[model samples]
Target: MRFFKLFFVLLLYGLSLLVLPPVSSSEVVWSISARVGDNVTLPCEAPGVVDFEDVAVKWTRPDLGPDQFVVFYRDGRPDPDNQHPSYQDRVDLVHSQLMGGDLSVVLKNVTINDSGRFECQLIQKMENQKKWSESKPISTIVLKVSDPDPIEARVGDNVTLPCNTSDVVNFEDPTVKWTRPDLGLGQYIYLYRDGRPDPENQHPSYEDRVDLVHSQLMGGDLSVVLKNVTINDSGTFECHLIQTMMFGKRRKRSRSESELLSTIVLKVSDPGSTGNRTETGDEGGHEDRQRHGLTGSVCVVTVLSVGLFLSKKAKLSKSF
Candidate 1:
């Protein structure tokens, strides 16, 4: 009976090992950030890969849905049929031949909506076997795409909408455009091209009211100063960096391919009303502090009175 019981225990343990899946080695999750319209790469690599053609690599965003891969490469080419629509024509392997086991991919023209967690997986098929092994994760990356914070100003006060591209060195003589999307297309607040301000394409309302700091242009500072801001000037502003591309000895400007460096929200308020609100907030805070002090004083007095009464009662009882 004892022998049979020991055999049963061993059988259960052996079965459990087969039923449970093997634990995979952990990979570090990397965090990366990029501005809108910038090209960013997600790093991934599979070590000990000699023949890249025998293996397949897949980059996917699991949160998007099942099978919604960002880039799927198998059989020596990327299979875009199962890829997500948003990533179509925008993603590709860093190396077409998968050099040095590197499975990284370049994501071009990123937008704010592309911020999410991405995963890189590797699939390998066994020799002389038609079935492929389960996909194993090689890397995990969290991408954050964003713009600068909004700017606030009072009416009649000058405000600077900030935009910079110092990190991007692709363009030497890029055109800077600051425009309000609410003002419609072709109606820009300021346009800088060919080392000078192009006021001919600027809106009539912004005439002589907007200026750029030419001294700081070389540092990639495309900041614009809006003088004497009005309440009606409150809106969303976009800064576009247009790169000049060379085509057979001729330089052509591609406005459509411009990168949106920064988006700033300018809020202009009335100075008189702002001052009144500040005063009101200060008065309210002062009143609250006074009430708190009074309450604390009352609490101290009550505590002292109880202690004094207790002391006197004890002395009277002792004398009796």
Candidate 2:
């Protein structure tokens, strides 16, 4: 009788082990970069996920404060009560591929203050289990932010506006638009899409004069050069990027995200008048200084872009 009792106890213990198994964990980290006012994707992919209908995903910035929810989703919708006020309308799941194990989130209108470390936690409901068991962290994403400063140039001279993507652009065909707030309605200074310029949609003043400096657009520079710039170019210039790509293999849906890459103020110095000058030199000397200023401005832009790229590359290397 004692042997039978011991056998029964062992059977019960084995059944309990099957019901409540030890949870495994992984310390995976990811680093992501984005510019100010850009819409970026923080990846948090998972594996072995059969269904997301009963899964719960939570994203938080623990460095900011305890229980600081960046975004949360469960029960077939976002949890309206726990999200932080600053990220209320700016955070969301990029696509509905949670079932395929993609819990990535898109952050809109990113600012310099948004840079920080984010944590993603995923919990899945088990069949016939009333209690919840936590899975290891899906990922820890570190957001690095950069700024695109304004530029200055002179009229009748060539100017290159610098703009680069924060992350690698994998879309089939991406479009970049350069617009001036001082222009008329429904018109842009430069419009490049699918590796070609849309001349019909460009402003008359910029036709055949503005072109993308970078021919190869795959994760490279998107800067444009404007020839024979005029005094009218002295205004706020905005660079916007749009791209469309397929999301998941099972879902036959496409997703597009547009990001405002940079906004620069071009201060065009008139050929006749030395604007913002103190009358400290002759006309010839003034022209030489103006040329020097333009060169210096371009150098500054180049340095800034190189610095940003180096920083991003360093962080990405460490993450991988």
RMSD (Cα, Å) for all candidates, in order, is 10.6, 22.3
Question: What are the per-residue Cα lDDT tens digits for candidate 2 across 1-320?
Answer: 99999999999999999998666566469888876667889988765545676778888887656656898788778887867878876788977546467788988878778899888888777677664456667699889988645567777899988777766775457778899877888889887776788786688888888888877664667789989989887777778787766567674645453656766667787766754354646677989999999999999999999999999999999999
lDDT of 1 at 158: 88
Candidate 1, which segments miss by more than 4 Å at Cα?
1-57, 63-111, 123-134, 141-147, 167-173, 249-256, 274-320
The best candidate by lDDT is: 1
Write one digit per residue (lDDT tens) for candidate 1, span 147-180: 6455788889988887777656454566788888
lDDT of 1: 0.81
Model 2 alpha-carbon drift over 4 Å, by segment: 1-70, 73-148, 246-257, 274-320
lDDT, each prediction: 0.81, 0.78
Weakest 10 consecutive residues of candidate 2 by summed lDDT = 251-260
What is the Cα-based lDDT of residue 94 in candidate 2? Answer: 73
